[model samples]
Target: MKSKAAIMKTSGKIELGRRRAVWELPAELANLHHKVSIGSSCFLKLAPRPSKHWDARRAAELAVGAGFTLDKPCFFRSQIAFLSVTKIESLPDSVGPKMQTLMVGLNPSPYSSASRVPYGRPGNRFWPAAHRAGLISKDRDIHHALVHHGIGFTDLVRRTTRRAGEIDPPEFRSGFERVKSLIEWLKPKVVCFVGLSGWRIVSNPKAKAGIQPASIGLTTVYVMPHPSGLNAHASLKDLIGH
Candidate 1:
């Protein structure tokens, strides 16, 4: 008896000898070219002659040489099925309408991301400086910052990184666009970017620590020093002064 694979090849069900091979539908052999399923895989329950009705014997025979079983009371189609999918969550921005000031960060740090809070990293001086400057209450709560002082927080990039150096130019571009959109939407009175580099990414590279000439709709922009423990350009006092 011929091998089932050989029989399939010899029967001209699928081209096998040429450089490029294709399946030959039964409709094509039967001159039923008008059928849209001619070039595509059609659902055939069973039997070599698709016009013939499906039965147990044909399914068993087809299953003998084929990799898959065409079960009884089931349809067969030539398509792979995806079994599972996953979605990723991004960090949330702390912001609201008509805020007095919005503090923008370069990106979330690993510590802040883990705690689901901005500038929550233990060694970071952002919270302390903000408190000292009367921009935040003694409490570390974001709600207190927003409700009491009208100070909101956001980031150029939502993704966390160990260091700002790890972020690429593409991330900077995306972050700048997001912040611009936020400014246009929220219309904060004053937008204070907590990092000069991040603000520069959104504006002129020569941007200083003071006010920026560019405005987002009616909002004004300002740049400040990054409060990371590693940033050595200014003392916390000098950062607050800026």
Candidate 2:
């Protein structure tokens, strides 16, 4: 990870704590992966009908609960309510005490959740940049990078969100508790926060990008810019440099 600390998937084997699972992506599921991993931020919002339906009044109330403003006439005219925040299945974290570095993100983007892979979103710069930086082979088999290369993955929050901006305060607080416990348990050599905002929220408010005087049990902590394309301050090369 760049910036001293930072943060999918390929088919091979995944190591979670002491357990190892055979990892493979079936070809048939590629369409769904493409939709969520590519379409979430750019377009294709969660629709209301498939999971839950809001009959006018309930939709408005729930929208407000999710922090959406109903004051605008143009807001959320589609059939789907954005309330499907929780994923059917949370992405599995790949972690172990023997790892050289543990990369942590703020949470799952809807795309990442759908694909069951960290930073699986096509819009994210993480995978490509890591390859460019020589952190991974050009083929970028994530399973090899983690199982054989001593890299691991995790998230500050377990929930999925269409946008990081939608995360409520309670979610962050609970997520932080879980993160601390994970760090204490694994004690990876380095714990890198993929986004500075995540570090700021759950960690020292004054901490900036790069190594910090933070530790969980024996693990060192650092912060870096998120590899999202939306973060303009850090480019692909810059991320590699970090």
Every candidate's lDDT: 0.56, 0.56
How many pairs of residues in model 1 come into backbone collision? 0
- lDDT comparing candidate 1 with the true structure: 0.56
TM-score of each: 0.62, 0.62
List candidate 2 segments past 4 Å from native.
1-87, 138-140
Model 2 C-alpha lDDT per residue in residues 88-167, reported as the tens digit of each score: 33454655446778888887776775555678787788888877877667343545677676677777665577887788
TM-score for candidate 1, residues paired by index: 0.62
Superposition error at 171 for model 2 (Å): 1.5
| Number of backbone clashes in candidate 2 | 6
Ten contiguous residues minimizing lDDT sum, candidate 2: 1-10
